[model samples]
Target: MSAVPDLNTAPTLDDFESLFVNNRDLDNVRAHLSKFNPIKTMRMARMEIRHSAILAWLLNPQETHGLGDKFLKAFISEALRGHPTAMHPSALQVSQADMMDTEVRREWRHIDILLLSPANKWIFVIENKFDSGQHTNQLARYLKLVQSSFSKDDFSHIRGIFLSLWDEDPDDDRYAPINYGSICEILEQQAVSGRHPLTAEVETFVKHYLEIIREATGMSEEQKELEKLARQLYRDHRRVLDFVIEHGKATDFSFACDSVFGEGLEHGNIVEVDNERFVFNNCDASSISFLPQSWHKALGGGKLYWNGCENWAMGFPITMWISLTVDADGTSGKIRLMSEVGPASDHEFRHDLINGIQNATKTNSRLRIKFQAGAADEGRKYSKIFKKNFFNVEDVQDQERIAELIKKALKDFRPEIDAIADILPKFASYGKFGKSGE
Candidate 1:
């Protein structure tokens, strides 16, 4: 093996070129990653909801998988291990109980998976998360909802399991933290030991699921080997890799947002307010929002209303959004320039905002604002002001096309945008009205 280069030295173009030439480790890593994984191929590998569904199928004793209650028992045993004293005594008893009559429920009361066995007086409230973290006191709320629904006298052993890809401490101590590694261990044992023999088809499916979980949790032998090779390669070409990573163009949704809106701002297409430039808030990698600075002042910033540009909407009472909605196949979708009123905590303010837009349309005529029937109702949170599909699905692949389409939409809606901007300042003084939490 060649001696590792000094990482302190700055990497040149020659160093970068060396990485692409005669790099066996890099080739091996690529080949390893190219190996077929059915879960990944179907695009169900990283989806948390799908993972929960698959787990529910496996955990149900009456399910067609034919593993009986073996998987369920093993799952419970693994969750309870090393933390018996911290858990309820009845819950500890559940590990030894017959789970053949267990009923698995997914998304029950918004919980990921709920397992109920009336025969054994046991209930398992499982909250599964693959990539995301628990938010809004969801763990506590789920446990509370389950307890209220299932009476303590009937279901004496109610346990909470926080199953995640990584070790995450649940907001509620009642939830026992369990990683996907435990799940892989259970599945591997069943597949190899043949304690409860599954049919050929069933066994194959289980093994496929096992492979996905192993890869996700970094438990697969192939993944471990890849990591080893990757580390070695990094050591060999540390300076070059560091330089590339530092100067690399981001290949995420945020990059798309930057390309479209950033260029629009530069080209004088997106309007600037009071010298405050439009800022893009990336709501995860799926969606992004660039709200005008005036909207920030009108909606009392993020503290009073919604935090971040959630659901592609910019401010609370009223705002516009340039949205990209992808289809199920993940390729084709439309880019829409849309605006909405309301969906705010302040109902009175929401109604006023909607009324102002509707009245503006009558005077200006060019505003072209229209409201659906019952939009002014106090109970209604969201009312569409206007929407225009500016870009087709085919235009999404080209960055230049996206920018051009956005500019055209901005030019077309300039009058309406200006009118809305004028009306927004009036609501700035509007105090918090009605109940919170829209």
Candidate 2:
């Protein structure tokens, strides 16, 4: 059957003047696009294009899902049009088969598309997704896989390619897409409203990339297919719009959410909501608790005892950077002393025994600290963690109370030596580096 008719779609650079890379009126731009039949605007399916583009355009680059990613994948393949090198040829293969289902194991490395260039001794393997970074490694991996499938003789002449359209690891070979329709007009709006750094970078990149993408706009089969898809999407959305205006809201909004969900989850309780989300309604949280101790005495601590020095130390892996955050709001900051133990005396802080723990108790309290000496590669490193992450924050008034308690506790802590001039009062000596204490 013949495809639905698309809007004339003869886009010119002038048509998208306002939507140019850095021009910022994004909301109006998107509103303008919403008026167009989306399928006809991008020349693709309405259901397929608009919804996916919305997500890919709104969220973190690594988080786009479903058809948005599929369209992105298709769009990237379209880039090979004007691009040429000692690698891929101008004409290439699309979604060509890599693995014939062995009458069994179905979807493995179902690579989105592959462009094999006999002339330039290259092969391009592509995997696309709507918005996020999940497929970051796919290009290199799929390229390697495709190359490995060939006999060693083919390896010498074959080079593989992996292309992704959205923001991926900065190292990926990305190019600015020179869009030409209502889609083109919307790119600037999409970037601005979304505040996308990578998309904003397009302003800098697009001017330079014009020649490359102009050729790509019309060259290969992938571009043609994409153009066809874009047209179909535009036509469909237009029909939807007409229907909506006449009848108010179509019968379908979250139309295929269920089918999409079923494709992702297999067993009980795993519901496919979106690419990055899941609803686990059946999970049992009651039986979960900490591991019991000294099932160890039964196991008779041999290798396992020293193997876990947790008894002798606060055992847990820590990052190279240690953070100590403090919060002193107003009404709620007093030490609920552990073991009826109040704050420490000067002797404890002076002796440097658990000074870190003591310093942490102070709201926004800074410290000049020395580790047990052998703590780091060069003795010790000083670093700071923001308050929200590190400290036990209390209301600002409570903080004063906590401090008052510490002062009361310090009255009892007497170190063997009182003449040591290097140790200063905690807050009095607080400085950036431990140097402030002295």
Candidate 3:
């Protein structure tokens, strides 16, 4: 049983039934709804399904499959009876039980769901909305927060998504460039088809934030592509604990004496870092170690490998490995870090930072770096390589060329961030996250 429909105040019971329960002709329903008032089309998502049972009944008119579907039934039964779960979640959280607050500068960080990879890369933020609207400053704030605390590992991939209702802008593309929209939808979009959980503006707003992340970072295509590849590799896993045990410190974190791939057995020379942090800080190798292997006896199964001279040892934690097509019998892609994990390792911050990565395979299949040479200086870089032996352009022209290069560099990061912003309006409602003006 459910509360009586407030047909006198809004659309009639017939409208609700046709739109959901006996929806054999959705396009016709949409067409009718559009012609009836037009405004109803945009406002329908704003209505919360207060009575899950009633909602379910609306979804299944004639007892179709005994109880219709379990998820829908469960969601409806609980809501109607007064128990609520994540399905009809209540997320007007003030602090970091959400992702909106993380990106804003100087705010005390409290990540809702923090993802830590064996390589130290993390998707540290997740935002939720009830509807889609033009995204607010929240998206930008999250990106800024990550940038502020970024390490080589932080750069591996900072993921932020809007789990909300539907898009505010009906005419715009409904997803981020990559499959980011799909990922967000997994968590935000409503079970009901056509009707999003949130609003369109919220999705657009989130996408705008992603654009900011991509352009501001100025990451190279090669690097961005590499990172994209690595994310795909680890998306479905549960835990990934690993360690370099030892690498150089931040002030002088550079290494690379020789080749770690010159011998006997093979999978090709593959270099992998936690996420793609080809850099590291000083650590007391003697004090560094793994999770004792026994701790995760039942989690899953992977592999391990290594190569290097006796003095400056090298090895791979099965948790930090990546599979490549070109790796026929152990030719390229092998990895080597410079250090040893012993009894006295650095423990100030148990995380790594990364930058300059991309996805070389499917949008879902990602690749990670096993290690970078101690000599790889992690710094801001320009994409195009100037091969000219000399510069003949006038000083002003050269200045403008440099400016154009800077602008072009900024343009590249847009794809990643924008991809994220595209899917934000499924779970949350309008006016959430304080509505940004810009």
Candidate 4:
């Protein structure tokens, strides 16, 4: 062990150099993490749909993974372990469901994974969310859909499983919550138990997936060791690490956004209105959102409101954003440019703004844009007034491509952009009573 450095002194150049000098442990950590994971290489590790598909394959007894109902049984057993009705006859029946007759369906009626065993009268609804949150009362809506879709007399044993990467309480209490950690343990046990031998290819794939789950859920032993070493390094060179992080290069996502929008704005390639150019400050990495200077002024100088909701990068009354969104199948994603009106604090103003835009679109064919209508009584928390997909998923990896696509989209949508911008100031001038109070 080396002697501990004094905490009272500021970190010097020597302290920073020591981090890379003869740091075999640091080198080992780097080498260990360099191992390839296919799930990550394809960029499917965090996709909820991919996880659901894999689970459906593994859970089906007829599927070629060769676990033959072992994984399903274990998963159900874990889900029902601490349930209030775990010992109920229906719950027990579900735990011991005949896997041979079970049919796993993906995206059935918009559910992530639905396992139906008509012979055993058991149905399992698994709602998997990897990186997103439950929206629109989805859990409850799924339960209601399932109940209405299936005949009660035929399917008496119905179980709803909320599967996620993190621990979250399901909106519907009847739905049992299960995390990726449980899935990791289950996979580890079955893969290593040797009771049911998987083919070499299947074994490799399972191990790879298990590695992904463990790393995501913080269950990997190697990851734990890496974290331990990292903490020790940080403690030993706290000042140096802090200094580097504070003044280091921007994050990859942030860099990409800045490169794209910053250059576009500088070159006058971005959309403009009334000589007012759109501005995108590198405030968030996940999405590039901006508004014309005049529109920002109209919306109370772009003050954030509502703290935003799921899938939204920023909270503003109205703005245009280009964000990445996953496809319905979850196999890939795309970048979409959209104009959104977020829930503003002033309910009356928000209501008037939404109506003003909707009425404008209805009368002027040139300004027509498809969007979900807000309630007449009040404004919705979030609404996309205009949307268009501009680039494929792989294009996001290249900053130049992102910049090119964004420029094209701005030019293509200039008419709609200008029309919407013209309507904003009219609504902004009206106060709580929808009369000119400005």
Q: Ranking by lDDT, best first? A: 1, 4, 2, 3
Worst 10-residue lDDT window for candidate 3 reads: 251-260
Residue 380, candidate 1: Cα error in Å is 30
The regions of model 3 sitting more than 4 angstroms off are 1-114, 118-120, 132-135, 153-155, 168-438
TM-score of each: 0.56, 0.23, 0.17, 0.60
What clash count goes with each model?
1, 44, 116, 0
Off by over 4 Å in 2: 1-77, 86-123, 127-352, 355-438
Q: Write the per-residue lDDT of candidate 4 for residues 1-438, one digit (tens) a residue.
A: 877877656778798788878887779877976788888776577766678888989989898988888888888878877777542335455566666878999999989999887887778889998877788788888878998999989888788888888898888888888899999888888875676788999999998999889889988888899999999988877877777776664533456566654533432134443344775533455566777655655644534233322134333467777766545544455667787677665677767777777776666776536667444356367767774435675424445555566666666777777677778767644323212222
Clashing pairs in 4: none
Model 1 misplaced regions, further than 4 Å: 1-17, 42-46, 82-96, 134-137, 151-154, 166-171, 215-218, 235-360, 363-438
Error of 4 at 258 (Å): 8.3
lDDT of 3 at 381: 18
Specify the poorest-scoring 10-residue window by lDDT in model 2: 283-292
Task: Rank all candidate structures by their TM-score, best first, as comma-separated numbers.
Answer: 4, 1, 2, 3
TM-score of 1: 0.56
Task: Name the Cα RMSD for model 2.
Answer: 23.8
Q: What TM-score does prediction 3 earn?
A: 0.17
